[model samples]
Target: MEYEPAEYQKLQVRQYAPRELRETAEGKYWRQFKAPIVAKQFGGVTHIDFCQQYPYNLAVTASTRVIIYNGLAPAVVGRTISRFKDIAYSGCFRSDGRLVCAGGQDGVVQVFDANSRSVLRQFKLHKRATRVARFGADKLHVLSGSDDVTVRWWDVSAGSQVLRLDGHRDYVRAAAASPASSDTWLTGSYDHTVKLWDVRAGGSAMLSLEHGAPVEDVAFFPSGSIAVTAGGNCLCVWDLLGGGGGRLLKRLDNFQKTVTCVRLSPLAGPDSAAAPRMLAGSLDGHVKIFELDSFLVTHASKYPAPVMSLGLSPDCRLLAVGMADGNLSVRKHARPKRAGVGAGPGAPEPRQRRAPRLTAANYRYFIRGQNSRAAASDYRVVRQRQVRLQAYDRMLRQFRYRESLDAALATRQPEVVASVLEELAARGGLAGALGGRDAEGLLPLLRHLVKYIAEPRYTRLLAGMAHRLLDTYSGVVGTAPAVDKALGVLRDRLAEELGVQDQLSGLAGALEPLLAASLAGALF
Candidate 1:
């Protein structure tokens, strides 16, 4: 006897299409999951930030009001009318999620209790519009930057200005506090400069760096050793640890429009070994997440309107985007898969287990030259094994409808069974495979198909095949009571699904004639 190479043995195998893999667990999780909630604001949403505390409430600012939403998915919790005289431009949630702070175009900085919606403190520090306001590293201080070219730190409990830093020649737009300490912070200005400051040192900036364009937003990496600034169409990164005047690390410019906002992932804590990726929202309707060191876009998502504000939850499990069209889009992160879990119990078990690499039968174990006594030689442990290829899959790929139907029925694999049924239905060979009117010849296959008719994963495919099978064998199929009962249930399910499709089709058909009449009327 001659032995052929494994590659040339002509064992049956099917080339799986990309869509077939979509039926796998990971694919189904990503492709089929739907967003559980979506809500709209009255005006363009200026900002959306999630609370740092448990229950993870969200703060949304639009027009003249600030609304706090509670729960994992957004639902209104409480709201506050910040300024009656003018629009509220910014809103932020404190580290404890107990306080909500916002800045108004009327130059007022207000802090309110998140739950009661009562104003805790209000500071009238800026002479012009207050563009941004946020709590510092500590709850005792609140920072606000305004068009008046000033950055003021107000004592929240004391309700007095602790210090005022004024150096920019133009309007101050964005500011961020360092996570490492409350004394340190960063602010961006329309004067084309980014200023690093220390609240401990009175009224002067510690360092100032030119950005060559009006700065839009500023954020500090979780470690506080790196600062990122968005302006015009570029993102500039600076190294706070570079000693001599904070070195320029890298400049990123992927957007064609002005970058509106930039935020660092809160998941990357101070003790993290690596810096967090940065999320930048731009006027071009895209939010780009970039890897810190590489400056490569790791992930990106698009919205129907320009992305004005972006916030990542403390756990990094959810991201909320505020769009220019007042649409708030929240996306949940895909959960990581566990290592040892497998397909459900209905999955087929392996028929043959793998043999040991070197069993006692192949290599006798010896210790100190004594005869091998390690369970000695065992033929069962050394036997060669090969997987039996799934015959139905290969036959279906080869277009052998009749043979594939029989092979699939024998294997009892629901997915393989559905594939064969779908292919037969698609190719107009379903009747031929059933051997019309020959009930004796098709009863076994019908029994196999009936076993999995109600399975959600394969119901649609089996339902159509069942309908065709019944029509072809209507005269003799009802002779068996058990088979007839199963067939009746399948018929009922298919009819219900068909009714839904018909209603939708009717709606679409009605719109066609109305659209044609409208076009004719317009022409006349």
Candidate 2:
């Protein structure tokens, strides 16, 4: 049977997409909004680090278990992972990757050689939890930020504390090293200020940003001329250039929620365009991206938990988000394309498509006005391309989504065309698009495949394209005929898979991040 939708059937697409996707999609339709990052959960993401150079990352659990994953699949790092006795508040890798250290809640800093995956050295630094560890370029200095209200510098080779900076009067939430100068370090605290200090230069702050709440994270842009701090519900930007002390740029207040994590693109350079980009995970469960010179949310991504921590790939393309659930969402972020950017003169124009990883239950679709046009010629051409794509999609899905997404992005496939048509006609995308969209036949075929193929979770990479169309209609309106037909389709589709939760408690504590931005003051 051929995949063709009746004029009436095409309108039914409104319900086939998942409720989470719909809520976001509907919100997008209201305004030509920039996308916040969409987050994927990683093994109950307690902490995350992108320094390892792979989608592979290290995340910690409340009990101090460190789990590692190589982007899509996960593997426990070592047999001696973290136990109740040796675990504590802070942990990080040395620049050479040979040594990784963790601060124990019991007031000890222990270093482990990752190659052997064994503890190398242990030094008791405080009476309480020592929260963080970092190695400075000058191999002589190792910095530890702690809840003990003091930042200590240790000579790694000497195995002793060389100096202790006591400026911060509250539990230090985060600490960072300056890119160009290892002698420099910055720390943010619950006391609402960030202090910069030099281990060699004696005492006092070199610079400070007086925010009003706990500053959860701090980072320096790759260029070394700017630094950012996330506190309360605002991301305060500062300039680290010019004579003497750096000054505040401005604060982005739209987040309307506390920011739990902050990171700067590690691969930035000196050109103004090369200015480092910032990515943040929030109490609201959204990862927001900020371009340095201009302080605005260039894009946003969503996750389902309080995004307490995040780190970026060495290349700045993948973002590893650590959610409260201990799941690390290794997601690909869109890299900035400088003008005059070209793939190749002879290569085919890249067709816009949904992300290579998309789960129908939590997927986002983008249909351009031109793409969704009722033109038969356009449909025919797209239909031809989607045909081949359908065959490949089946093979990939069968592989438990372990297959690389390179294939989904390899050709100019009309996947969007096939998928939208299927959903409109009551056929799901996974099986229905692979098979043709014949109303009667498509539904039965989907039922068979549904039993065998479990869907992968999808994060929205690009949603504004379809939202642009939804915007024209104003809250899902259409011509009288189109509206009636769309309702019929939405109604039937919703009845089948659209579940609703009448009680918020059933949604669970996991959804806290999802509500944070909307209820900032009430909870925190």
Candidate 3:
């Protein structure tokens, strides 16, 4: 006669709360960027910009120099423009990628030839430090914002100031030129306001919007109908169209520190069908990517220090982050190769084809059923695998309840012990199982209960088991020294757990009034 094995009971799984950030396709795409290539600079990296042409070199402004890095090999410094006598800011490339411009602490804005590294033009009209400088969309003009609370337009050919707009009451630090028109541009100032200017309209700003905080940076949508401003811990979106004053479209306050930079993805091209994303870097060392349509964070990356500036390459293949610690970290995403194309010069050689194997008539072909595959209509024989019962399961099969509990306890697995306890309780034999145990037999169980009773997962089951044990063994407690000691330990542990819960409740109660007052003030 064949013996049947007892079935193992399945244990209940512990569930956890869902995380705020989930793994999505966009997150996976961002994760494909490999570990960064870190480069140290003499001073904090103030700005980073990638040229909009082939070979897309990057211009990084730091200390008193603007360093040009090869776009394909970001770790290599292609050229350095060290002509600035003072610290430089906002090093950027012209549309043609042949020229680079940067503002200096000496209140000068200079343009340099990318290949020659010679100053092509210099404008020193501002009375204070020029913090922002970039080429306009037309490529013939330059725009600059300075600490003098003024914005200036410059002619590259004549090396002279074309126009000066002075509406901002404080330092003008952030600026962006409109992609649709060369005459239109915007500036964000420390006065907590963003103003849009059109050279054709006048020397005055055509539109102005209050940002509610010291403005750090500004960016325009490709269509030029919308704009975004970065300020204290927030990004504000404004509608630039039908205008008494530009209307606020949305306010994004997901950051915990000041937002230092904001940029739209695919910076050098027309908008694609896929909704454009906004990239924002903050002093909290986080770079967050948000979908323009939904305005929800799609992905985020953390840096080692506060991110002062960041740039995504025009091709979207490179991401460079500038930190306050003077570290420049660049991460690159390798493009997937086509079906049969080799990756590069170092790709592995193709495997050679081997000679055909021996025919089925050979004994070696059939030795291990190596080529056997069942056909759709063929009848197949199924073999049953022998079941192996655990010690507790074997003991339970024989109806030895106390021995099964002892066996479960010997395994030292909490889940297995809990499952066995639940099985005994379901059969109406839990009390019987726990009964008839001597001091030596019951000490392990008591210790396990004491250790796990306060755990949320096993609390309810262990508590009931503990109560039953105390009731059954109340008369036998003082007879055994070990049992009495365990009981005292259990009492102390329960008291500590109760004290923690009481303190937590008191803290929550104290916070309630303050929360209510803040909510009321916000509502009013």
lDDT values of the candidates? 0.75, 0.58, 0.87
| Span of ten consecutive residues with least summed lDDT in model 3 | 336-345
Over 99-170, each residue of candidate 3 has an lDDT whose tens digit, in order, gives 999999999999999999999999998989999998988889999999999999999998898888989999
Over 1-524, each residue of candidate 2 has an lDDT whose tens digit, in order, gives 79885322211112234536334321232123223333333344556653342323443433464444443233334323474374445456565445666676787777776556676667676767776777677655678878889888887777888888888888887888888788888889988989888778857777776877898888887767777888888887777775367788777785757888888765442222345567787878888766666665666777777777877645444456677775555544333222222221222344566666544554353322444557565545434432333533553435422121223333333343334333323433333223322233223322322321222222121122223323434443443453445445644543443343334456766688768866986877
Question: What TM-score quantifies how close candidate 3 is to the native fold?
Answer: 0.72
What's the residue-level lDDT of 315 in candidate 2?
41
Which one is best on lDDT? 3
Weakest ten-residue segment in model 2 by summed lDDT? 456-465
Ranking by lDDT: 3, 1, 2
Which pairs of residues clash in candidate 3, taking residues 3 or more apart in a chain or in different chains?
none
Report the Cα lDDT for candidate 3.
0.87
Cα lDDT for residue 247, candidate 1: 86
Q: Kindly indicate the candidate among 2 and 3 with the higher TM-score.
A: 3
Tell me the tens digit of each residue's lDDT in model 1 across 1-524: 99884432322223334444334332233233246246688888888777777556778888888877764555454565554468887788888778888999889999888877778898986899998899886787899999999999899999999899988889999998898888898999999999999988967788998887899999888778889999999999999779688888999989989899998876442223345668899999988877677898766667789888988766555678888898887766555222112222222344566865554556543333354445546443455667445676566557677777888778775666666666677778776777643444566666665566555566666666766776767777657776676666656765776787799899999999999999999999
TM-score against native, each model: 0.61, 0.55, 0.72
RMSD of 3: 6.8
